[model samples]
Target: MRGCSRRAGRAARKRRQKCESSIQSVSLGHQLQYVRLRKFLHQRGFTSSLLQPALFTDTGRGLQTLKTIKPCQLIISLPESCLLTTATVLSSYLGQYIKSWKCRLSPLLALCVFLVCERHRGEASDWFPYIDALPTTYTCPAYFADGVLAVLPAGVRRRASEQRRAVRELHSSSRDFFGSLQPVLSQPVEEVFTYEALRWAWCSVNTRSVFMSHPSNNFLSGQDHYALAPFLDLLNHRPDVQVKASFNDATRCYEIRSVSGTVRYQQAFINYGSHDNQRLLLEYGFVAPGNPHSVVYVDADLLCDVLRGDRSLDQKRKFLKENNFVHNLTVSSDGPSWRLMTALRLLSMPQTLYRQWKAVLLGQAVCEEREEWSVHTAVTLCQRLLQDTNAALEKISDLLRQCDPAVREQLDVVQSLRQEERCILGRCLEALRGTVRQPDEALPCQPDDNDDDDAVS
Candidate 1:
């Protein structure tokens, strides 16, 4: 029996090893493209070989270190020649048309146009390998379908709409410029520069481009700070990772130095400037789960509803707006943000204490009664948010059941976002409840009818 058990255990180990080997094989399937990209970069002076493209189970596609990289080591240094910038566009076949155009083209639009034109050229283009390595379809809000957009949280959905509108307006305004490209293209300008084509190009540039400031150019309408770095852009963002990236004047290459060391064969990361999950999803089409910077934003309308019975609602609203405190009110794991608490404190004050508004803003001590009122108001607001978040999550679950596989993927992102907000709200509520003397009676603030005579004070 002991001999049989040992044989069975050895067989199981063999099966596990085979499964892992197959998974590794599948993960590196994109090596061919990376190979071509490496060759392309090497010819143009990309020398650092510490990192290589690999599929990470957690981050999808990211750069993994080929060797253990020590802190402060230079991880990548791509020569300026390898970077695709507006300068590249200005020197291309479309440069003459762009230079002679009646109005100057924005740096962003120029990059989009260049990307679209080169993508159209395919294998014939010089930057084909770099362009080919780009994601074919980005998950940025600009690419989200209407159905997917509808399920997003109110704040995210609003921003998503603005993003879509901006992309559409850009496409509409560039028709004349696109037409000017006809002399160089085999296909009609409309066929080559369709809205979808421009949208794809726009997302590619927006999501992946690295910042590289270029000197002022008369032909470009905006700052020339955008550059599409080929293999370097593959470094995914992690909130904890720190890196110093700059254009090294001495080296004549765009360099990224690791402030944080990476383990061998592990995914290497760079910090993307401490972005919240909301901003990450909106701008980059992905969210960092448990992002420390994440917060649940309090909508203005909802806040007003929570403070509906306050006699000085108008005054408080104007005060908040004037102080720039009307926006960015949020709840995080710690509790209500200072801005939200301050807003609530001012709004919860009785008519008799109306003159103390400025003192409240300055964080002066409020009377116990007023403090309790503010706490109650915050608790009420948090409960409402929790209710709404729970309802939205349930709705997303239902939609997930009905959605196709493609839509399901988009819905999943929205679900993750909502779930994070829910967790934040729950924590905020628990914290608020613990502070209330009569937690059960922590009702919404009501208009002080007896203090009406002092309302004008």
Candidate 2:
């Protein structure tokens, strides 16, 4: 009897455990059903087959079970009823949206949209009827002012306005991002300190500055007559690079225009900051065959290798033969020209020599009187390219004669003509002017004794 009771107790315990396991299994089914139902709601035309079976399976009994389904999934079984229910819910939640949509679909609104789109129609009939008619501007609540339409219907106006504003915001932002290059061009080179900063700063200023700073390190020397050619000036190198433009010509004056290809201006973009400090090298002579606009300099060596054949070694030879090729005349801190050093002074000193010249010409002084005179001296050198040649020569001669009549008498260098003797004389006058103007000016003349031995090298 004791064994029999123990066996019966064990059986009862196992049965209870089995019942609990079935209950937990059903709970798991409910979880799966929830996920399936949510996914169904998100789908287009999702109403029936999905929810009905899942709900019936989870609850194990419902009107959805093909019997008593008035309150449950069976409603979805009837397509028309399901759609009606959806419309009712949507109307309750967003009645304003529905009313606005209705207005847009109305005949009057359709006609207005058509007319606006047809305004530019070239056909006579398009505008013939309304050409002389006074445009009747409707006082309808615009979509711009309200979040819902308030044209008699408050919510409708506001909703329309909100949509319109959203669209306008998108359009404006896009316009700002993808608009023309004009705004970028108008920015000054000074605004961007480095080549990298100039990437987005427009092409004009950045390219010009780059050309000024990194011009080919070339200078022509012929006995007493030596000058920096504008050939490399056309290159317009950036400041970071140490090279400069160097070229020569058979003519007395350095002809920069010879090397300036029509498209050389476009090559300026090669040194833009955004382009990894790369330079552009353009070479084309085939289909566009030697077009001035087709010549460019790029930074990529691989591209250079690929287009190496395109690079006119023959043209380069021709260029060199026609014009004298010269050596690099890089001016260091200690150069012959005080004006050149002063122009570069802006790097160490915030005051620009150009600005100083403007002050002096206007009869103002930023530093010592002699230094102000030095500023004026600097301006004369820069103006040599454009100002009256003979007058400039006389001005220097007069200034030289005032200081040392003997030296002026010895070197009868006239600035009027392009000659070796004249250039040498002008240079001598420039040196005298510097010394007379600023006896105490700490001009970086020659390297000091304590300076490093390789200062010039």
lDDT per residue for candidate 1 within 1-457, as digits (tens), equals 0000001367865863464344341135257777778889889987656876777655678777789999999998889999999989999988998999999999999999999999899989989988888888777889888978887777788999999999999999889889988988889989999999999999998888888889998898878889899988988887756799989889888999999687777677887777778898898888776677889888898888877767778887898798788899888988999988888877766666667778777777665666677777778778888888788888889888897876777777778888888888888888777788774564434645446322212
Kindly list the per-residue Cα lDDT of model 2 for residues 351-379, writing each as its tens digit. 22323333333334333433443444343
| Whole-model lDDT, model 2 | 0.25
> Which 10 consecutive residues of model 2 have the lowest summed lDDT?
277-286
TM-score of 2: 0.13
- Alpha-carbon error at 287 in model 2, in Å? 40
